[model samples]
Target chain A: MTATARRVVVTGLGMTTPLGGDVRSSWEAALAGTSGAASITDSWIDEIELPITFAAQAAVKAVDVLTRQETKRLDPSAQFSVIAAREAWKDAGAPEVDKVRLGSVVGTGIGGIWTLLTAYDTLRQRGARRVLPLTVPMLMANSSTAAVSLEFGAGAGAHTPVSACASGAEAIAYGLEMIRSGRADIVIAGGTEAAIHPLPIASFAAMHAMSTRNEDPQRASRPFDTQRDGFVLGEGAGMLVLEAEEHARARGARIHAELLGAGLSADAHHIAAPEPAGLGVSRAIGDALRDADTTAADVVHLNAHATSTPVGDIAEDHGLRLALGDDLEHIAVSATKSMTGHLLGAAGAVESIFTILALRDRLAPPTINVDDIDPDISVDVVRKDPRPLPAEGQLVGLNNAFGFGGHNSSLVFRSV
Target chain B: MASEQEILSGLAEIVNEETGLPTDSVQADKSFTDDLDIDSLSMMTIVVNAEEKFSVRIPDEDVKNLRTVGDAVAYISQAQG
Candidate 1:
């Protein structure tokens, strides 16, 4: 650890997920072992003949939360980011930091796909003159970060880390660096994704990466289960108010957890598939523990990146075993995606919020729909019911998020 | 030729849907930006929706001339001719 390094902590969290609209509702629904997946009902579902019919849509619609003017100007992804960021900023008691020292780092895997496609359709059907002037700005991948920056008047910097699924966690990691390097005093960091449209669904189905369990949408995302087929695509956003420890303390903010540190690595094996040996994933886990100045023995809970894919779940199991060694048996590993579905870019941020809530509440949320546990998964999977944390000690938890491009990220959080 | 009342009502509906402003509040002489709080981007949406509905091509240069609901309604009605 560097002598000049500053301590970063999480002051507030906000999330709009498939499970629920906000952090409190989502956390409660996750603990209750509920599945958010449902059959697609949009008109395009039948028009495209998509093999995968169901997805985990956000429990609350963006239009319901945001004004019509806001929704019209921003894409769905940016809308989600703005909604979650507003909640997080308010939750932090609206810190009175200088605009020059505030920052925003929101990431997305596929930004503004809906807007891009809709604009193209408008041009084709109507004419070139019909295309909206704001199309380019709305369709940019960095639009979410820009929207958040504008909302908070952040002047330090606005960053978007496009690491596929790991983008959200990478954004948080970047926020931690911003504070540690004296670049910013407080940063609103997280991710948002709103690609539940037909094109993305058809593409994922074509790649054989989505579950085809149309008849049983609720039980489809059975991560680590023998009957698991593939992941269900979901959309939403999650944000965290990350501040330097001294700054948060001075402001008397309610600190949820310590943003210990993050570890990142890439498999470089496949563009869409994980490394079969879990080498990169294991390295990220080990690096996170080291960065947090903790060891495997201190870790008690893990929010695994078990996307309900056949190969992905096993690879994560192998990574956990390799990194934790004997301690893997004691950690209460939960696959919250079983309930929330795979949020793609937002997965890491939402799961990190779940990990923080687990430590704060001293309870590990249940991983539902494990009718038959896979024999290869050796860790104790918290299934059917929520599990209590170690009754007495300061709890440490790890949240792992890996993306299609072999981007592996691990964050370590200690209870405040 | 489209009637002035039809143009005004159609434009008002589009503006109300885009800005979430009440339909009754979209008076003909009221300025879009000042009365409805519709910004430039939303103004573009209003123009596009109006063009599609009335089958009239309102050029970019003419957009700046459309400050009030009455101006947009008159422009679309005259363009239809």
Candidate 2:
């Protein structure tokens, strides 16, 4: 039957987030509308002299749990990826695979910025003789994928897509293609980022895109709220193990959900802000639905790319209207970053975990701190208390993430 | 504190650290280009990073023939000599 089109299924999942270190805890925090954003506190915070101060760092630093050697060699971003991937690998019961048939696709918006910056400091202070030899490998964007591939001995292929904020979603899309094209039977896939440094924070702040709510870090990122100012920066990673449906079923692995579809597009409009009308956003959502062989009516929930920015939220609503039409009224949009802060490149993958859980539990997480909904956004955004969905036959969910560089991506997942 | 044998061991570690693989997985006597799993760009990165770490300048011609750990150690020893 033409190999059944090489259906893709998610067999394992893992995450390290500002809310919590694992998927269950992160989802729980999301449902509770708890914010993970806070002030800068790392050792390097003093060096960057930045204006935008707060961020949503991982709830548990990878160093606390990972081996000393691992932390020494890998960048903070790669460490998060490897940590999450290891959990996912073990969660998948560490399946046996032909090394040639296993693959990886991980993405980072900015690779090794922390490593590069830190090493530059070392060079200025201690001279080149003492510069760490591990700096280059630690800083490369593809290092996370390479690190994970080595861990699993995945020789099929290792891929990294640098699509800014849409990277995580694009990585998943790339993983889906690997299965569809029969390049790999299984893939370790996700995005990781640790760009909460002061330089980037100040840069985004200079553009007036960061919230000045330093007093209340938790309430700083208020997406779609009338009082919303801007997003808080965050760091972390989310990884998933996607395998061919037949392969996963053959091995009797538990299927978290089906990898229904993924769509990617570029706005080609702006370097930072999304197109005023969200032209690419609509196209991305529409393309994903078509790719999944599904429709707007099937999508009960949406994990929006609402980074608490005033204009971006409105643009997304416009895109939703164009893509889903009348179904927009019934769809429940969850502004997850309203509490998690913007994880930047890691946002899509981190938020996708919440979207998948919404499908699994038949409930939509509330958008907290949204004291007043934006008049510009027309759709029904779940607010206040946790939202419960009516028991349904099958549930479909959509996740949207648009990056600074006009990258737009949408992923659709449904109960298998 | 760094003996000849210890220096040779440290030289071996440079390759292992760069590639994230065990040294036993690759041979000391073999050419890094012909024998190791690393690519050319990675090899270049290894050369640059190792040169800086050792505080020793490695001429481009010497870098070309100095493929394995043994070659690197012998070259360094001769330069120091």
Candidate 3:
């Protein structure tokens, strides 16, 4: 069979999120409609006056799970990736595939910001002689990808797609392409982010892109609700082991879902705001469905990129209607960001895991805190409690992720 | 000026902090690369930290010559004097 014809399947899954430290815990919290956002307890928040005083910090600190050497050498971003990758690798039964046939792809929105800023401070205060030698390696955008590749001895290639919020989804798309194009037989793909620092929060606040509902952190991220002012900042990582369908079957690996196709597009409209009409979003969703050789009628669930911003949510709503048409009403759309908040670079990878789980569990998790659903949203959103899907059927789902730079990505998967 | 024994103990503490190798294991006779298993990056960290601790300058060119824990302690002691 041509490599293009080779099928890719998800064999393992892992993540560390504000909701929980691992995949199982996070998924459980998501299903229970628990919100991860809370008041900022970091001492740095007191040092600087930031408008937004709350965020969805990771439930378990990455440093607590990593070794002292690893924590010292890697920044928080790479540390999260390593932690998730470790769980994912072990979940995949720690396959013994050749190092040459394996690849690692990790995406991060802002890489090692903590390291860069701290190193710069050290340079000005303590002089150049005192700067740590490993600062550059830790601060680079590709640090997470390099660390993952080195950890697993992935020789095929190590890639980092830096497309802001869409970065994580782009990484998974690139991994799918790598396996299809015969570059690698197995790929570790995911997105990680550790940008909850004061500078980023302040920057987002300047753009009015983040919600400043400090009094009610849990209800701040209410996707498709009229009350949502903007997105909420969250930090964590999610990883998946994608192996060729035949390779997985040969090893008797447990399959989670079959990754059918991926679609990526750009708006070319504005830098920060999404294409107001969501033409780009529609194109991405259309392309993903077509690439999967499926139609809107086959899709049953949609894990939307609804970051709870008024404009973004309305635009995505329009995009879903344009692409899915009347079938949008049948899809149990869920915006788990209402619970986990927006994980930025890691959002896509984490949501993709949720989509797969929704298919596997035969239920769609609810979009919490939607006290008043916006009238503009025409689709049937799973709210209040988990919604059940058909227990027996060839179920298909889509996960959408959009970035600030007009980047849009849609991934399609099928129940195995 | 730090005595040889004092330098040895201080250097051991530095090595222990950097590599998690116990201070007791960082003997005067132990080679940094062989016995202590310190890599180049870690060696640089230890060198810079040791320089600050002893208030001495162990130039980069002189680092390769300091093969063992004893060599580093001796260099720091001499540079202090």
Candidate 4:
């Protein structure tokens, strides 16, 4: 941490999640403990005979929010990105910052899967010339970043971090550094995912990474519970307008929360499974607290990356216990993925937004479907209803996101 | 073979569908790029749809010669003949 490093604060937030189309509605549904998971009724599920038929589809389709021309040009992932970015830009009061001083970073675990698969299908069925001209651009991993960058004329840089589920948190972290490093005054950073198609669902299910509780889709995602099977696949996008503290103050922008710092690490233990002892997870958390110049004692809330997977939840518990030590008991831990399902790449960003809201409102959202809590989870898990945070002073919260290939990312947020 | 007026009407529909231009506004003298604001990608889409509708092939090289709707209509009529 350098003395001259600029402070980064969140000025705006936008999202289109399974809970709702916008941030407020989604937050409200989260507070009410509504489950976004439902049985996917798309005919392709039946055609493919997928083992997992349920997923958390976006509450609002992108076609409903975007123009016909925009939809024709962009893939589903890019469509979600553009929709969220539009809201976030408007939420930031549509700042008139110089185009060269602005930037965008949108991360995705899988980019334009629908586009790629569909284009291939078109080629196979209708021949080569029938494929759309924009297929390559739409299927690229950086398409969302490019779309948002073009939307706002962000010239400082357009970056896409593809670290699986950790992608979103990494993007937010990158935006924080962009401001701190004096590269950009404001950066729109987050993640979007539209991988609810048949192929992805089948692939994840083949790895036994998804729950098969098709009868009760709402209760399928049971984090920190004994009966938990696996994660429920989800689709959505989350975005945040991150600005330098000085730039925000100079422009009189309304501040949402302060992004104190981020810590990222790799496990190198396994490709898909987490390290049993959670050494990498602890290091990331410890580094984040250290980077934020704060101790575990100041932290009062946590938005855990409990994807409801059987071993994954236990591994994260071990990691949290190792990092926070005795202070872990004091933090009100909430696994909002029980409501939003596992948003994959967007999970970290959406969970970050929930953490910010928790700090702002002094209330932590609940972790639903924990009928029988796991005894191994020693942390204080907020369940059923929203829990109130400390009312007296500045509160700090942490959001963790771990991805496949041993990627781990943790972000710290402090109330203003 | 379709009449010249029918070819123009069919081409107008394809152009309208591809670029969202009004069919009535797709005049014979209107330039696909300057007048209709259709870019090259959209022109390709329109060409493909026109090929399917009129049952005539418009090669990639000849697409450049289709500067105006009148040129496209004339080309399709001759190709069909």
i-RMS, every candidate?
1.9, 5.0, 1.2, 1.7
Q: Show where candidate 4 strays beyond 4 Å.
A: B1-17
Candidate order, TM-score descending: 3, 4, 1, 2
Q: Which is better, 3 or 4, measured by lDDT? A: 3
TM-score of chain A of each: 0.99, 0.97, 0.99, 0.99
RMSD for each of the candidates: 1.9, 4.6, 1.6, 1.5
Compute the lDDT of residue B1 as modeled in candidate 4: 95
TM-score of each: 0.95, 0.85, 0.97, 0.97
What is the per-residue lDDT of model 2 for residues B1-81, given as tens digits with 9 covering 90 to 100? 344565566665766766766756555576777777667655665766666656667766677787676787777666666
DockQ of each: 0.59, 0.10, 0.64, 0.44
Better of 1 and 4 by TM-score: 4
Off by over 4 Å in 1: B20-39, B67-70
Clashes of each: 0, 0, 0, 0
Q: What tens-digit string does per-residue lDDT give for candidate 1 at A302-351? A: 99999999999999999888999999878999999999999988999999
Q: On residues A203-287, what C-alpha lDDT tens digit does candidate 2 reach at each position?
A: 7889999898888888888888999998888889999999999999999999889988987888899888889897899999999
| lDDT of candidate 4 over B5-40, digit per residue (tens) | 999999888776666677999989999889999988
Model 2's alpha-carbon lDDT is 0.85
Q: Give me the displacement of residue A339 in model 1, in angstroms.
A: 0.6
Q: Model 3, A1-416: lDDT tens per residue? A: 23357899999899999999999999999999999999999999899999999999999998789877789889999999999999999999999898999999999999999999998998999898888888899999999999999999999999999999999999999999999888998999999999999889999999999999999999999999989899999999999999989999999999999999998999999999999888999999999988788899999999999999989999999899889999987899999999999999999999999999999998999999888999998889999899998889879999999999999999999998
Worst 10 residues of 2 chain A by lDDT: A44-53
